[model samples]
Target: LSYVDGFDITRHWGNKSSYHSANDFDMTRHWGHLSPYHPADSFGIQDIGIPSNCEVSQVHILHRHGQRFPTTAFNDGGNTQRFAYKESARWWASGFFDNSDGGSSSTSYDLLVIPEDGTENNTLVAHDSCRNSDDDIIRCFEDTTQGVFTNNYLKTVLARLSNYLDPKFNLTIMDVYAMQTICPYEVAYQGSSDFCRLFTEQEWIDFDYALSLRFYGNRSFGNPTGRVHDIGYVQELLARLQNQYIYVGNISVNSTLDNNPTTFPLGQPFYLDMTHDNIMVGVLSALGLNYFKGSPTGLPYNITHAPNPPENF
Candidate 1:
């Protein structure tokens, strides 16, 4: 058996026209960037050489998600001051403002009355311990919208892929695997808070619109802040993948037709694991080669190699 990762046909086309202005973005700029589309020869299939004896029984394509919205929050001066002094002080000290004196204590923003030791602090504090200022929360909502857009874009890409595969193979019953941890990490203001409320209807609408823009336009929200950890999850995934391969390999080798062998003849049969750049790096770490290096050409692991042979048959 032989393996050839499905070629990425869209890389040379650049982002959709709706995503950029004519002057700013150019598809040709990426013409020779060493993507799957940039074959050394005239024929695109020349890049992926198929072995003569081996058959393409299966193809596992693990691809990165499409371009994402910026995840970074734009904290202007007003937002900074509002969070640092006002929200922080109110949350930390539990003190009320002077205006809530006459209103019902439960719904009021008054912070003067401290709850007794046994008294439930639920009313005074937020439901989620992680809270950010109004602006920050709005920004986060916007960022989340981008994630939603990414999902939709992925669906579109998959639909196109399905169409492309329909003629060549029976893709109707192909199994698709998506990572469960495929979500944007939340951006919290301080370590103490976990959730922020988008109080106004306009704020909610704006967030949805921002997400739409990110999906349709390919504008990034910027990078996320705060700690993002994936160590345990990654380890679990790796362990499962290894166990699955081991079991499958053992079954194949022990079958009545096969002789005992040290290694699986064509290597363990498996499909691609769809994941993010972060997860790819995590998997690579266990496989060694942890040092930082430049991008991947046609070569794997940043190592240079001769181009694959052209199709002889």
Candidate 2:
């Protein structure tokens, strides 16, 4: 009878050109038969089970970050520069010469002189040259580092949760705790690149320096070793919870008319954890509740099936 709801805040930030409100995104109107809330005569538990009596013991909200400026090849350009550099290096090693460098016919140089009108034309050549020769990619790195999507969206959502809790619950103010992934720099910078490759000595040093700059703004460093610390944080919290103690005392009084009049007391406490989408999906999938057709809420008034409970629970 516990009142539990699963929500993905990022899902609410759907394509801006489309629906505007939560009601508008209710699937029934968007995709016809594919909608979870179709027929208009059906009802889901979320709609009909209002005014539930169960007090919320805990809430675990796992959601994705807000809309991101598309990071795939469709948006922030591709790995064309990296691939081109590899190709150029291979061609040069195989005796391809750039005649631009003056030298004896027998004296060979390893450089690919891309033509002005080819695929590697003026624009692409200039971009590659800047990214390779002068580390102009730093500007791209900085642009993403200072971007606003994640931080702003997270703050807004947290504020909304705080406001909702203040009026809806009677628990002590300090009972609620919120936590998020700590090493966002790693998440943001790694992009789609594979990080398993062994780095050269200079490459390793450069990576360390870049990581320092990312975490500490090139001044003071904090936990530059990546996301391993989050595991320790989680373990520490769990240990504290396991070690917590509670006590209760009984009082007795005598009544003149009634011989057996007594009361029993009970005590309970709970914990809540805030996390992200992948963790939720992983858990749901493990519990065999990850399957879905259209929307999460099923059909409209009485049409589609309801969301299934997690099998493990």
Candidate 3:
């Protein structure tokens, strides 16, 4: 049987006045670049070509976490630096600064946009620890990735700050990626962040240029687009995923699914796991998601064919 398209489903079941298909949220454009993890307008059916007599009795699902910044801290990767008041003033005086912020020199400054000090020590610390023992299910898997402040998340923090911050002073974001990701939301939401207040209507037009560079410029280390190309990590996760349902003894066992569902109905009613995009891509690869796999000319180990953020499946 052919799968029902999302648009068709929406037309049939969604409110007629405001129905929107998942296609409306295309994940290939500027905002769509935040795909895979981006919210879907509605869930659609996938064509499996099952026999007419067959019926689906059980469903399994795996999903990535919500919007977040690159795992490697900006400072660690040299992608961002702490805001320096003296340096900014000097740059502006020497004409070395770009007026991405709309405010002119004649405009009196009330609020200052600066970065927190001691950013050098912003290292990737262990979020949790896991032992090697096979008996402990809770301690078997743990996420080691670290996340920095970027993307739509910035808007969330900035919105909160606007309530207490003064409107007189202009704000500037030193982190390019953070600014790029936050730019869209700032334009839509008036009370976004103090940093957003710096951009005038005219400057907002040219702001896309800066964001493009931050997104498409550097290719090494997954710059512009934060992606993981390490094959070792991908392979590791794929191995674990493939073995996730294979039940073995307590020593070195990896299966999570109960072999006998009739005997253990409540054993695995619902399974939820949260992970980073890098690992999620690996799982997708193991599951044989062809579309996610990059072109033959491009290497998967280089993130040419990997799952990006906000992908819903």
Which candidate ranks first by lDDT, i.e. highest?
Answer: 3
Write candidate 3's Cα lDDT for 193-256 as tens digits.
3333333322332233222222222211212122222232233233444533234322112223
Per-residue lDDT for 60-138 in model 1, tens only?
A: 3333323222222352112222122223333322323243333333353322232222222211121111233134544
lDDT of 1 at 250: 24
TM-score, one value per model: 0.22, 0.20, 0.32
> Per-residue alpha-carbon lDDT of model 2 for 22-68, expressed as tens digits?
53332212211111222234334365443578665433222223212
Candidate lDDT values, in order: 0.27, 0.26, 0.31
Instruction: For candidate 1, give the lDDT.
Output: 0.27
Candidate RMSDs in order: 25.7, 31.9, 20.7
Clashing pairs in 3: 35-309, 36-310, 36-311, 37-309, 37-310, 37-311, 38-310, 110-169, 111-169, 294-305
Backbone clashes per model, in order?
A: 17, 12, 10
Instruction: Arrange candidates by lDDT, descending.
Output: 3, 1, 2
